[model samples]
Target: MSQELHPNGALNQANELSSMHGAELTERYNKSLLGVFGTPSRVLVRGAGCHVWDADGNRYLDLLGGIAVNTLGHANPLLTSVITSQLATLGHVSNFFSTPTQIALAEKLLEISAAPAGSKVFFTNSGTEANEAALKLTRRNVGTEQTPRTKVIALEHSFHGRTLGALSLTYKHKYREPFAPLPDNVSWIPAGDIQALREAVDETVAAVFIEPIQGEAGVRELETEYLRAAREITQAAGALLVFDEVQTGMGRTGQFFASAPVLPDVMTLAKGLGGGFPIGAMIVFGEENTSWLTPGDHGTTFGGNPVACAAGLAVIHTIENEKLLEHVRETGDWLRAALAELDGISAVRGRGLLTAFELQTAVAPKFVSAALDAGFIVNATDEHTIRLAPPLIITREQLETFLAAVPQLLTAAV
Candidate 1:
């Protein structure tokens, strides 16, 4: 009988369990965890900067950046310090009492939003919760009117979140049909069609939710002109324009808010807001008390926990002090140009660090698998589109490494 050897050589039972590889963890996961996400591609153990190591000790360049949640990359020192310190000092307080951390983060979000003076914020635990808040706020904005606005218009191929209310606003039928009877009066129109938007947004609508860049829908971008039209049409009809910036906010798009050009009346942000810590926020701008949600109308127990807020403040501070916005702009441009020139790439489009490319051959998953085998992480948004949202702090040298491997990776898939 042959003894099974560990990756490092010796294999005692204790050593084997201690050094459990990706396959072993995956098997355990199958028995104990829900299968909602299907089989995860890897059982990663640790991450640093733009790189992650799986249980098998294989290191891969992380281009997905925790699905765009890791703004400062994995295990960022500055963000970790803030989180640890805040947790040690004051980790969480119920919504009954306000904390400076919450107020400071809200003020920061408002500033980044470039909202008016009296603009207010509502915090949540995730993007879905933030969108939920937006939905409720939209409904509440119809202050004591004879006929309250009840309709919501969202763009087709858009993704808001998975909650009951947010799912109603989402455009994917597959995700919505399973949980039917979602909050009523939601309609969808093809994105980037100004005419469609003009027709759909009417006086009966409470809000029109749009993703400045539809990250999940293959990183599709809604044109600035289309957004402007939405704003104009929604405003004229007294409908609030809600921009779901969950994937595009927090310096992912160079600008602090992707809705900066269109200036949406309301915006929901999360993903990288806490630089890997979980936190989400909804900003309601426009005339001061015009759209404010009354107290007790919307609330969250752990929405603005001090630790998360501290982590968020650290993320913003690092972006400013380290000048990551400018870095994203420069690195993203170089990457887009490089990807466009790649042998298998057909088209490249996105803003700042959030980007995607169309493959000449419709085999994005194949390419993704090949990239993984070659020690790189990338996402296949669809059969033909591969999305890249590497950390905002990903360096030029690290990008060069991935760029150098592109042709071979694509060739393997081909």
Candidate 2:
């Protein structure tokens, strides 16, 4: 016996649940919702292409692209079509059964992985799980299921995610400080410091995790030379190099997985992997390392949701069929140029679709809000850094429109 709530009251109920609509609704949300994010921005009602409309129908350019997850933009027809067709065919079947979409996605991921000796993928629902699974597999590689090795070296300002294992690896103190007794033995190394990494990785360390672009710390691209150096260091020491491609993968960094100078032994991917749907994977290289986690070591239920896999398949196919990497390379060069030309923007960082600018002043929040007022969506991470990770499908005209608004918003603050 169950009762259905009408959409009329449902809207109000939703507002009461966690939305910051009006003073009354805001108060209700404050009382119940976790205070982590503090307050909600306007409720986004609909989205299309690179634009999103709030509940009040105010449209915005959506340059952040849902924190880089919406690589194909909001409500992409391809994502919608694949998800619909897959749902109609078969949606969810537990690990007891197999679906074509699930197996196909795994195979496609491996095809893209195409490293020496071939790789295998493990599915998860989010980047955090992908990282957690990767970390667990790393533990196994260190040998001894009993006292398993504990040390992991992560980069400073790197953001893996908020889960216990991933949080342990995240470099930011604020995200990890509150939870003091984390799953231990994690050390923070400077992003591009090869010697420091050399010191950090001894025989005791199980894995070394890094993000090619440290997205949360205002987009720091690890030098390819340093990456190659890390490879030599890790290989010599026998510690695995695990790349957390949660932000820069899936054609975002123009290389189609931040295809670095040195291939990592393990790569974790999410964000744009499913093109908007939630899907994450941990790819282990070759036979020797790919079998790190036997069955019963790690798993997820809704990770390979048929619809998500189909959406991922569509996303990968679209990236290849539509030839988006070329667009990203050319458009990214132009966007970086246009952004760097803006007065008072001190420096531009990142490559491909993932790019950012450092402000000469300390009013980045104001700049972000001003951009919103100008009908553009951009974010300022610290007092001096503005991040821009837009859709891979954004056109030259669309990028020009965004570029046209930068100088005004940036210089307007002062």
Candidate 3:
């Protein structure tokens, strides 16, 4: 038997839970939530601009930007207002219905992508879902069940998503081993290896997925020459080229899409698409590819919710209005140059705000812990790599503070 509480009692209970400090909240989280993420470093209460306050009332600069999801930073007034206003007007409707906000967002995505006239967009609740939809769309290019173009190519060290279909395309052994036998016939190629891509992609191949900047793989990048070669190879073989720009898109690389001029047949976007709000998009370029996924082929209940679409619009509008692309380019250059000169730093890689540096010693975990203790937030992608993806709005002065403390942080870690 369960005990029932009065409405006021439930409200009070919520208030009490919200008022709890870091340690208590962490304990509650451990008990209530799944342990897949391990223990969170801090129970953050609130955020503003480029900083967040933990439940214990300590402030820390947010350099990871919610793993490159918070495009406009935390608690942005414009984003907040847009979301609230849309919620008040129309929050959600089934996929059977359409909304102005959703239509406008689709139009905007196609425009920014420089997609051809007949290009189309499919909305989803997350990057994983977007990738899943893309996988299905790619399968459409496969001739038929009896004589199917069964091969799909993806780069080694890539992280697509955790879902089964997207997981099949992801190249990590650890992530795939637990799932056992994902969708078959997917081939893994080395990143930026034009020869491997050319050799792998043939008429029997349906599609090839590439991340312009491989964020989870320590900000590894695919060069333009390689991308162009991929385009040519896939085109010659009549296979689709897909760019998974979940991390590098939406002004993260100081551009709308990281791989420009060298376009793909399909592109998937999320992460920063809604500026912290949950939304993902799969843009299929050209008339032929756009027509592949017809009605009833793929559908999502809350994919194109009005509120989420409104949030995406606000993020894009803010980026344009604030001219953040230029800011990201300039600041990213400065930040990378500074990181390269720091002690114990061996190499810096990345374009715009999506950046990472290798440590001389394999103490990235310790370095990250020290950074958190010093009121700065960063991520260790591996034992030797630290990735930084601060909010686009973060200023030079704020980054300078972190830069100044790097030597001391490295010393502490060592």
Candidate 4:
């Protein structure tokens, strides 16, 4: 059994956590909630900074940051203030009318993608929606080839999103198997295999959607040689190189957009980009890709809500003002080195604050539960791998403490 630290003085209490505040209330959602994610472990009630208190009043340090969504930390004042102020003034107005926040965010995204000055952007409310938009744009660019603009090359173990269109691009067998015949013309090649990419891609391909760093594949990073080869092959095939930065964008990987020397024709962003709000964008560079959809090609309600855009703007500004990129770079190196010393661990990979480590055994699910008992929270991407994508605002000291205790936590795993 674990214990909780008392609020005021010192003593920790046994985590006999009889009943969390919202535990009972959450029980009613079991079947009605759909078994997609299964029953959640705890009924969380409040969150501040990187800590969350469950219904039972147990506080835990959240290292996953809601799967890397809370970039500035939970309930960040800057984001909250901006949302409150914006909601007070203006909320959702249809796309029929243009709002400054929407336009401004679109322009800011273009600037960050480093696309040519006149690059265009389309905003959505989630990473999947952005991928949908990008897919449409790709179809438009290919324009009815002999194979009908057929064939898409995506890396193995890549996770784009859940929507039918996005799922077609996502390579998870389970997600794709059950939902068979997803928007077709998609194929897969090993993530870092240059030869595979070279052979798999050609004029028949429409686009190559890839994550600069594969978050779902346990933070498997694509080597530079691989990225370079992908660029060459995709270009030779006349296929657009699409970088899905849904998990690595907005300073998560120490870059506004995760890429190397070659700029992607299309970049899809979500997750940390909006700081805790839901907002996504599909960036199109060059006139050829920019003009994919002129009008009435695709549309969504609440895609560019002014409130969401405000949150995104504040997030980007905070990242710049606070210089979070440097923090991620330094802290990431420190965490990686420290984890190397932790027992039951094997290898670590990733960049900036996005990192994943493989344990020597396939007990990560047990390990993750034990981590919660130890006052820390993490997500296991695989049966043998744990991923760490803490909020970019986490201090060096916090990570050091977590890393130092990882060995002991691993020992506790059954």
Candidate 5:
């Protein structure tokens, strides 16, 4: 038998990885990596456009889009070119300094967000970090020590992030319980309950966090009226309103922001921000809200690095240049309509490319497995809910392939 390879030995054999099949790679993965994410379903080798191939040479349509992060899809020429060019010139700099690419990206974000004068941005490397920074901003709104505004409001069925601070605001027990005694005083009101919100916000509240479309909760959308009421309620009570658009921001929801016009005092973004590159940001609206965080209050080492910012800029420019926003709206409508007519679908919900469909029976897991076997990548958010946040660059013909297979997949699942 061949000698067992140590973890470091495996790392040294990186060149040989391409030759390893899925089973061998998976077995090695289980031995060397932490089990938090469990076993990965496939050993994806490479990708182009909306398609990826496994180590065993299986080609699959990637419908999950790296959980909605690959805004321009895989191997996007523009995104790749910008990132490489920036890296060749100036890849990273200390937070004590900033690059032109970083500054331009922040400016573009403010503009697309329609943020008012004196708005500012804090950069981070992922969605959880963005939410962490926003949480700190809310804490800055603390009143006098005697009557500190410590209470935070988040909707039931909401998901913020897994980090300690962001996790405090998340509602699921399974996610929150093990990390017992999270930042205290976070209240969860039923989503879309205006009266409950009215009762929850008060002078002692620091902030209210909302996700316009709750992606993890099966793409449940909070009505526009409720969003408006949230704005009103938070403003009246002197509590900052925060929109966690980590999954719905960028061009994922057709519009740049899902709750556009109904703006929030603070907005957190990630996922699609840098196409496939990792980047995140927290936008503080208006001069007053922007002043809440000073230089020493927060910072990140690789947050505003030139290459990531360059990637972000390319994503925005491409989205605009290609008129993807309009395409997303049109395509999303077509996909949802088509999904609704599928045999096993019970209901479809979402706006733009961020969508979820409920099954008539609890077969989402089985259906997802069948989908994987049939050369498609999809996500089962729960027993009956399957979410689809395909790459913004995915075409109708690409989506149709999965659509055509759904009937057979559903039957196989049952």
Candidate 6:
């Protein structure tokens, strides 16, 4: 028989954890909830500023940041305050009319993206909806003639979203095959290959969607010149260049927009835009392009809710006021270097806070399991890839502690 010990030196038999908060809750979840996610990793109870506590009262340094959604960390006071205040004033207004906060957030996005005057915005509740809206816009841009130019070009190993239209653009066969007969006229090309992009994008293509930094593909970042090439090719083909910055936007890539150098005709944003709140926006540049979608072309009931917009405003304010961009650049560089020095890590990829490390062996899941036991949170995006998208507000000391324990954790995992 084995035993577990409490921090206060009390011995507990292994079977005694049946009454623990996490165990009990997990059991309840397994019985009641759908098994879409397989099993709950942890029954987290509360969180604060880059850390969370599980139901069992075990604390963990949250390096995953809700899969890069919790931009300012959990329960940020400024973000919470704005959301509460906005909700108190005006919770939501249908697409019939817009609120001040909603309009302001749109203006902020335009400013951040350096979108030209007359650019337009459409909000959604999540990244998938945003991509869905973009997909519709692309289809509509060329009109629905007998042979409409509705073809879309995307990169392989990329993830756009799960919605039928968005999933059609997502390159994973496993995710796509199960839900076959998706919207047709979509093609995949190798990422980071300008020639592939040039060969794929032609007059028949309606749009070319690329992630400034491919987040779900283990933080694979495409080169600036490649993006420039995409822009030129898309423009020549009269096709819209759509940049999916759902994970790379809002200063996660050390810049306001990871594709700022090569501006796209359409940009889809979500994830960190509202810190932790659910909001997504698709900004289309060029007045002619914006004019393609007239009234009734697209709409969302709760896309730009005042409360969500307020949360987004607060997140942007905090980032600018606190100068977190500079911190992300410095800290990300430091963290990359530190992780590279680890014995088991073969390479590090990505920019700013969105990072992924390649392991020496295919033990990423084992490493993630060990990291959980070691009081840290990480994600195994693939068998050999560990993605780390910590809160931009994470302190140097917090990351240093994680760094110090990396070698030991890797050894134990291997």
Q: Candidate 5 regions off by >4 Å?
A: 1-12
Candidate 4 residues lying further than 4 Å off, grouped into runs, are: 1-22, 143-148
List candidate 1 segments past 4 Å from native: 1-18, 143-148, 287-292
Q: Would you list the rank order by lDDT, best first?
A: 5, 3, 6, 1, 4, 2
Q: Which scores better on lDDT, 2 or 4? A: 4
**Candidate 6 overall Cα lDDT vs. reference?**
0.89
* Candidate lDDT (C-alpha), each: 0.87, 0.84, 0.93, 0.85, 0.93, 0.89
Residue 193, model 2, lDDT: 89
Error of 5 at 227 (Å): 1.1
* TM-score between model 1 and native: 0.93
Residues forming the 10-long window of minimal summed lDDT in candidate 6: 1-10
Clashing pairs in 2: none
TM-score of 4: 0.93
Residue 335 in model 1: lDDT: 90
Show where candidate 3 strays beyond 4 Å.
1-11, 144-147
lDDT of 5 by residue, 165-188 (tens): 999999999999999988898999
Query: Considering summed lDDT, which 10 consecutive residues are worst modelled in model 4?
Result: 8-17
Candidate 6, residues 1-414, lDDT tens digits: the string is: 222355433534323543468878788889989998988989887899999998788999999999888999999999988998888898977888889999999999898888888898898989999999999988876734664686889999889999999999999999999999999989999999998898887777899999978887889999999999999999998889999999899989788789987888899999999999999999999897897788888888999988999998999999999999999999999899889888888999889999999999999999899999999999998999999999999998999988898888888887
Clashes per candidate (backbone, < 3 Å) = 0, 0, 0, 5, 0, 0
For candidate 5, what is the TM-score? Answer: 0.96
> What TM-score, over all chains together, does every model reach?
0.93, 0.92, 0.96, 0.93, 0.96, 0.94
Model 3, 154: alpha-carbon shift in Å? 0.4
